[model samples]
Target chain A: MKQIVSPGCTTGPFFPVDFSDGSEDLSQRNGLAAKGQHIILTGHVLELGGKPARNMVVEIWQADASGIFRHPLDPRQQDCDPGFWCWGRARTDADGVYRFTTIIPGAYEDRAPHINVAILGIGLTRPLVTNIFFDARADVVFECVPAELRSRLLAKPEGDGVYRFDVILRGENETPFFVE
Target chain B: MMDDSTMKIDYAPYDDATQTLRQIDKYTPSATRVPSAPLIERPLTLSERTGPTELVSKWNVGKLDLCRLAPDSPRALGQLIHVTGRVTDEDGAPVSSVVMEIWQANASGKYIHELDDHRAPLDPNFTGQGRLVTDEDGRYEVFTVKPGAYPVLYSGWWWRPPHIHFSILGTSWMNRFITQIFFPGEVLNEKDLLLNGVPSRDVRDRLIFKPTDTVMGDLSYIGYQRDFVLRGHRQTPELP
Candidate 1:
């Protein structure tokens, strides 16, 4: 028994400020109050020639405008208010560029009006789940979600509430790893 | 005298790091309820994996996968993990028990799902997924739930760091490894797009973070060690 050469995987840390448990009364539902989605959300972590990725660890997860899901079969909702932590975590200080301050989320019907982004590249093995739209509606949620996730959606929407979503991680149409 | 080669690990201990971030807690991965509601009587699926493959045969475990511990931190309830690991193929040897399955993101990445909304709060110890079978040299273990840290929005903006997600199979090996482990200096591994998709920097520095060691009396939770080989034929079941 001796044929090992399969070791090389890292990239896991999209949200671990110790697991931001969003609590403004569970992210305030119905009455509204879930809007602080901060946005330093820079970009650089290059490598495929771009060059940057200093330390690595940029995780982020969303869902609070009533769609409900801080987690655990529907955590009931309404808990992240005062000072707001709609969910944020960062790790890229050498130049790879990573920042956070989250909140801007409020829309969920599940037909085709998406907002579910995941990156977990912290140590690297696999995880880049992509999905961030709102550039005045990216072709109506990419012609109604589900064409293999409508081409990973992201039509350059940077109007203050911020939106860029750049993750080429590894060549030719790369960035799409979602099973959870 | 439980010796199949003598292996055991359960964790807990780390005073600072924001008190280990309030003792890790976040699990919300629901495709939509049934995890437990007065429901306990099923476990008997043995083995199966068909279609669309991200490999989710009802999240596997069978025999009703237990679930009762929740009294309020009885050392963080039952969760479960016996993982031994050591299944050599392609060229390596060992290859005994085999049959493994794992899933993560519980310490609080939210995953006890029914279609996730991300509220966070479910560590009745953590189940995430487990079903062991590997010990002779190709060790294997399972106990479940420690995966917290969930958030990501990239290009547009947001972040997440702190993770765990694994799945394995054997007998010519089926292959599936979405690996993750970081906590040593955890500043959020440079925008974590799967650690920038590992282009290599000494293997992303071996996926950062590792100081875990517990086993004195056993309060449970002695994890954060990593290993995954699978590269003999590359099954191509899909979901890398």
Candidate 2:
């Protein structure tokens, strides 16, 4: 029963961002790379009218290759991959394409392999929450998603460890969103 | 399930009551991103339950103080204020260790960023960015300058009221609330598009923080308090 206390505002046209330190490349830390299939996750964010979202911040968090989370709340936090940064960030380009160099996350308890995403832009009004599933695996949450909408959550593998996942913020084929 | 122990991922579906309007008039709907389709709802699960708690180490360039970019830097040019708040759940349980951040314009309404084309002078000592985590009691305090209002070049170029942008990462990823904190009685609060976009007047008022009498030794600052209420139960799960 958590209620909305305050409605957030738009970021206008700018905020603070410094990605010069390779934060977008989450596949490796220092010189040691994470233990998993290195992959290129890239996608485009579009508005309902097919206009490309420009210069929006895109963040992704996922489990390591062992299906273990690095979060304190996870029961298996201690077992996480030491070399895995476990967090990635990217901003949409002029074409609205955001790219991240990450590892394929392992499936956790009752969930399929996936990466959680949060997006914010000048006109987004509010942050949008969603996930990029690796496949149509048998999972509780994936199955619970309305049958017709689950496809929007699944990422398309475009060969050679490269995946494509597009997000449509509103209107037809709007990527399914969630709130806990 | 797994090692038998005991745990359940209670999926929380989308609750529109507390959710922001996806298609608020000019504020959200734009050519680049609009609410052409209704939000398709789904149940929250492990994907949303577990979050990136191990932040700060990577993104924290500034700790709790925004009044000065660095310890030795001169005080930022503006009225210094102390912002304190707690993150709690619906049942009034403290949700500790929440990752929080604050970003705002300088006292002159200009951000310390490249995209800001506004003519306001940038305070070399004020980066306008600070990052921190709620303490064990789900409480946090940040020392920053009262940000100045800037004009939004949307249509007729209306001026946005002075506000602080807050990004909250609750226990769960889905509770990632990105909002702003406005000072009570700001003249612009009545016309701010994003603030008034909120459907309820009572809830809209919640966005404004209350003034409190606070002092730190010889240095006194205008103190404000606002508590954020997130969703779900917060008691830590019993370890197996």
Candidate 3:
């Protein structure tokens, strides 16, 4: 029997009941307000057969370096940067390309944590959530994620404020994605 | 072996992550040659419960403008009802300029997402995605194909019945909603811990199915209508 790694389906639901839509105009200020620096984190969603995965919903939520979320319900609004909503969502195209344009988040006291993503495709009972961290803080943040996602946190900073990370769904070196 | 009329399986173009085939890999001999499953007929009448329906109002429309369904979009089953509607704050106004992204499987149960690659080819005509600005009337339209039934990795098990995943963001940074919209009359709805967690029947009813409308355009697309109400201390938040 092939071993399947993943704690039973429940990845704590982060769905924002207050706001469920995914269309945010680019004109509005993104999570990083002052820091003109932005990174384009893009990747393709491929099926087990290696074809582009289309129409899959990809959601990402993270705290500003100051640990503030865009959610109004967030109780600890301390250091909440008005400039940073700190969360975004996108759908993968037929080519499986899903991209997010935002600023490099600063670290929080929560221990060098990184942004997390959850991908909910068809057929699964639960959603597949994963995390991505800054290369510099990989060591500290590595432990913040579960053992399964630790391997997939590897991200190479491509030139021009863009980082490239590929999500591997299966295999011996399979990478698991995470979310808080 | 030379007498065989079989051809070699081309695995080169596929990425390394996908080439590894194991028993779990549904795409082996059955995966590639698998014929498209027949779409389920939508249901007759879905009982609507009461309470707060998970609302999906647009906040911000992002750089990704395309909202066409993927080829993998489940053929609409007569039994499955789709419910799509616009969400706004307390004020009866539409929040325009937003994108509504949804994912689901066909009646046979399959998600169009690439990760669910074993089931269906990405529906070229169906994006399983849509975009809209609340009409001047605070209304938004969702154009998508119904979802299908598919598989998942749980405790040595499989699930049935088709459902949809919804992610709605505002036109600005203030509010965003992420939710899953389930079809009515599904036995799985009761089994689905998430669906039962909602407090009220009214809210749960909002997640039920309805017919797609062609008022926006044509009936070729599956349409589900529902309205989202985002209440807060104030009205719409300005774009940050």
Candidate 4:
């Protein structure tokens, strides 16, 4: 018998209130247009059995077009975009789908454009950390992953600055996860 | 290979007694256990390292008060309490300037969120949410009320022990830790399956906060201290 439940699920259900305010739409900050190409990232959170994982909270944090984060710990010399709200959070709906309206983040150091994702919900023991990279820059991070499984991390462009990146929590073809 | 026999090595072999103790130490019944799931491990890249940004302005936007959200209201409902703690690394060294986000149910066992539709009365003056930035000495303090225990529809009906949710973001993505703090001496602590999920008794005890006497002017608030040790050799165990 398993001795412990995952951290998030142990507390029972947590219906996170939308704490992001209007920051979900990263293209504009405080009503002013941000300096970057606006993009919409959409996906579904699925269980290992391929069932919809409903009520999951998904959070994304990324750098701005200038490749600078707003966090005080960041030691980079790049200037942060005052108009970009680099953090966003949302909950999955009944269909286990989550969407975020943001811009394509610029590259940082030797890495390409990617968005850092953290997922948590009732069944999750801890928040799952992962990355979503574009198909063009997938090679930069997916070098060690088999060619067959690399596509799981790629978010394909769906025309007009929109991308589709589904996240499968478990089972065959599950999305790649990262540990600290 | 150089001189195996000359080098002194300390070791303990597995035995029946150790096995039995291990079973007790790691035992968590399936009925109360959260099942294991698949996870991938990868080193963080430069982008991932620089991705997360502080939401300081957003957290500080409104009147920052966990006890009283409404500035006009003098005091929030329920017993006033003070929570103070320090953030440290696994080595017990202070980790300064870490950001912590916290939220909890109101004193009436009801959340301020719309999704919480329990029959309990909502405290309009209390939002039960706030953020704290650790000082140079890794110390932080917040004023809140004792949250009421609430019942959930688990196994017919199960009442959860009073707890406060915490979210801590360390310097790196690997240091992100989320967990709950429970008040010490609550009878329900022994029966709480969630609290029992932690296998180590000593580690589990670390999650509980003991009450202390702390006075603020003429008003006296119950004081509680709980320190958080971030990632390192003696890193605090996450819920699992």
Candidate 5:
């Protein structure tokens, strides 16, 4: 029998060093304070067998506090906060924990406040995309997800504007992943 | 609604040959095997469409050279190289203005990162990180030194082939992908498990970069070409 390799595990053990300013902190630009309520998002990434997934790259991108993006295509670019980084990246530690210091992204048009997530590493055959919605207005988005999987998408608020959202890559209670 | 004769039956599970055939599904990579859940079929929302834009600015300083962190520092030592390539969709259309982040170890197999505890001497002149945006023609080029092979203890005592990690951010969130580029004719290509993880020989061949004779003045810098075909359309069927 031929050996069957795991899918989505094609790319590497990418060690993303800080290439540019604001690469790790979305709440600030280089060292300047960004406009919005400062928040620290923390979580752990686990494998299907419940083992800590280490050295995996986790990237987050979100709109600024004024509900605007910094892209050239976004018409609402005028509302973008000049000091907001709007993006951040962190690799999991030995225990699979990754954290980012960013603002609570503002809700746009019909969608609630959320941060888009992308996970890449050796274990993944392809990049995994998901979203982390703040618990404040999560009900609006939660209604769209299946009842059993809705809880996995919500990030509970701890004190001091801190939020927690753990990610399970596989197994019985895997985190909800969105298709492209 | 009660057409019993037209209904599909499950009698195949009772046969020995059918049971063997059913096991083949386990070998294929699907949502059942991978962590990615099935995409919920729904129309795009405003937040999903307009947000998650390119956060890095186009005027970012030092977005090309990977070897030196500052102009005052001494230049990194190794064979000077120019890595050039084009970013295109599966249909052969150009993908312009996309951000590509590349990082790798130094020529001595040592990384400047704090987590890299390799005993190799660190090169003060080499920072090992760079970023660039594809031009209108979907072309990008970078100047850096050839990185040396490094040992990855987790994958046995063997050394990892010299390769550069790439993180590509396309127009939309769905178009985002990450892959590595390795030099051609590296003896360790056949031994590296991560490179071997790509089961298809043709797909694996696409990852390697071949050297070209293109020279820059009297600097004697090496030239490498490796094009990228990002996810977009299905592969065209081959003629028999």
Candidate 6:
């Protein structure tokens, strides 16, 4: 690899919770409701070897119902919902489970509706970067996901607005991470 | 089989896998957690190209100086030092407004975290956490003390030299870089398992920051510099 930076180091179970400064709810801003279908997103983060990844931090960023990102990088005209912050953070509990209260992200240019997730954990040398689409078969860029790995990246819907997704970091039913 | 967004953006196949960490076999945590499975290579769609910029500015985040809790607070116990660095992309262009968060052990080689039960004395005034934001030139500086060395638990006679851990958030998700800043001339740099895990010797040296000629703060604090190069946008002349 031409990249020359030092690879990375494990947090060694000493990560400071305040460093992340993350949130669990992105659907409301300053007590105002964000546009679109407000839903509950929850999941577990386990090692492919089946170890519960406790105290690890997860960050999620997505577009609002207008398919507009709150970020300045979205080149489109600024039109995101005023109440949606478009990003959140959650830490896995003792059972490796994390929960987030947000809304269904809308599809954007050439890409399907999805949530971008970046994770940092006790044992992970590098933060695992991945995305979770809303379905088994998503449109556009998701096609790049191999058919067999599609199940790993799709969010499984429960009875109501709650969605369950599991992130397996190594060895077994691991979700496919992305690199440009 | 690809999207016809030819008008919007061009995508590239997976950039070859990132540098692999050569396990030292002693650090049991990474040995089991490092993914052995292949990761999916994909294009830098909007999701990867954009992220929450200036996260620190929005929140009431403050604490760039670790030696002192606040400007008026008492200085933590240790030798105060100022760390300076520039963040750039592979193209050597500056990536401004990036948030760089750092965590380290106190001067006694002890972390304030509950997991760390080392007998080293923890400075009551020091939490050992600091954060900074890069300027338009991608330059950042933070005030901290030289952390002490501590032994690796369960590892026979393994000691980690003074090192600071860094998590840098760049323009996008893929640009996120996690690394450690080592002090130059520290004998421990040569013995650190995680530092040596990096395959290349040259890259290992890059992790060590060197002293700067000019002074940054009052004569009390010393300045050291190291520049970082994060992955940049893939070059595609064929794209619109």
* Highest lDDT scorer: 2
What DockQ, between 0 and 1, does each candidate earn? 0.06, 0.49, 0.06, 0.21, 0.20, 0.44
Q: Mind giving the per-residue lDDT tens digits that candidate 5 earns over B166-217?
A: 7677655545656677888899888766566554666567678878876868
TM-score of chain A of 4: 0.85
TM-score of each: 0.25, 0.87, 0.44, 0.80, 0.77, 0.88
Relative to the true structure, candidate 3 reaches a TM of 0.44
Interface root-mean-square deviation, each candidate: 19.1, 4.1, 21.7, 10.9, 12.7, 5.0
Off by over 4 Å in 2: A1-12, A19-22, A145-151, A171-173, B1-19, B28-34, B56-63, B214-218, B234-240
TM-score of chain B of each: 0.26, 0.86, 0.52, 0.75, 0.75, 0.85
- Error at A41, model 3, angstroms: 0.7
Q: What are the per-residue Cα lDDT tens digits for candidate 6 across B155-214?
A: 777888898888876666666677777888888778787777666776677778888754
- Give the candidate order by descending lDDT: 2, 6, 5, 4, 3, 1
Per-residue error (Å), model 4, residue A175: 1.5
Q: For model 6 chain B, give the 10-residue run with minimal summed lDDT.
A: B1-10
Task: Candidate 4: give the clashing pairs.
Answer: A3-B28, A5-B34, A6-A125, A7-A125, A48-A170
- Evaluated at residue B121, the lDDT of candidate 1 is 77
Instruction: Name the top DockQ candidate.
Output: 2
Model 1 whole-model lDDT (C-alpha atoms): 0.40
Count clashing residue pairs per candidate: 123, 3, 95, 5, 6, 0
Worst window of 10 by summed lDDT in candidate 1 chain B: B43-52
Q: Which lDDT tens digits does candidate 2 get at residues A3-110?
A: 444455555566576532366888877578899999999999988677788778888889899888776667788999988877777888889899988999998778
- What docking grade applies to model 2? acceptable
lDDT of each: 0.40, 0.75, 0.44, 0.66, 0.67, 0.74
Per-residue CA lDDT of model 4 for A1-180, tens digit only, reads 111111222223554454545546767766677788889999888875677777777878888887777754455524778778787887778898988999888876666777888887665545677788875554355665556777788898889888999888766677777543
lDDT of 4 by residue, B64-164 (tens): 46877565676778988988888775455565666677788888888876656578997778868777777778777888898898876444455778888
- Give the TM-score comparing model 6 with the true structure, all chains together: 0.88
> What C-alpha lDDT, on a 0 to 100 scale, does residue A96 get in candidate 6?
91
True-structure RMSD for candidate 3: 17.7
